[model samples]
Target: MKIFSNPNISKVMKIYEKSKKHTSEGVKETDYSKDKLELSNNAKELQIALKAYKNLPEIREEKVKEIKDRIQQGSYNVAGKEIAEKILQGVQIDKKI
Candidate 1:
């Protein structure tokens, strides 16, 4: 094995040593405290909205009772055009998905 005395190798070694010293000197001991979480105004509002939505009834009893009453009284009337439009709207939504 043979080692050559190159000026470039010496220059690189010097730079590496300088950087090593700087790295060691620049580091300091760090003290970490407890982690904290904070929500923004929008996030707080969204949480409140979500809570409210969760609390809401899945089925509206009053509306259902009114519809049932109308149906029993034979007063419930639905237009064919309205039903067809709703069907077409459902088809459009399905196509989009």
Candidate 2:
């Protein structure tokens, strides 16, 4: 119960100083307007993505069985180059973003 007896004093003070520096650097109260705009944009983006996914193709149960059957029959082929090309395209697109 003595002052300065706690060894955590220096640790707490160091953390506090760091946080204070960050606040002085640029921290400000949250802006509801900008936050709401960003959230709405995110929701719109997610909805668009979901719609795109649904529109892409129906590659389920029947497709899975077909692929499995083909593979078991030793005729299942994969175009690795196409996959690599698509991946590279994605990377390029991300860089543009």
Candidate 3:
């Protein structure tokens, strides 16, 4: 049997050959380098500042001692209006959330 004698078979064979050639031509050899990270001067300074900030004490002991002394002297007074305002502000923030 002569398969090429059939016009449809010949057309399909030509398409298969062309597809093989196109696919072979499309083959690419790629070379990849390892990814790198480079920090700017500002970034380096920020990292150092962050490290120092993290090393700092969370609470101010000197301020706490001064406040304690004032409270002992019966002079550490907070206004009622200020306390009410803070409470109201907290309530408004809670409502927003």
Q: What is the lDDT of residue 36 in candidate 1?
A: 97
Q: Per-residue lDDT tens digits of candidate 1, residues 6-62? A: 777779889999999888877755456899999899999999999999999999999
Q: What TM-score do all the candidates reach, one by one?
A: 0.53, 0.31, 0.47
Distance from true location, Cα of 96 in model 2, Å: 8.0
lDDT of 3 at 13: 94
TM-score of 1: 0.53
Task: For candidate 3, write residues 1-97 as lDDT tens digits.
Answer: 9988999998999999999988877775445679999999999999999999999999999999999999999999999999999999999999999
Ten consecutive residues with minimal summed lDDT in candidate 3?
Answer: 24-33
Off by over 4 Å in 3: 1-28, 74-97
TM-score between candidate 3 and the true structure: 0.47
The Cα error of candidate 3 at residue 45, in Å, is 0.7
**lDDT string, candidate 2, 8-97, tens digits:** 987898899999988876746544454343458889999999999988767678889999999999999889998899999999999999
Residue 29 lDDT, candidate 2, scale 0-100: 58
Q: How many Å off is the CA of 2 in candidate 1?
A: 4.4
Please give the lDDT score for candidate 1.
0.91
Ranking by TM-score: 1, 3, 2
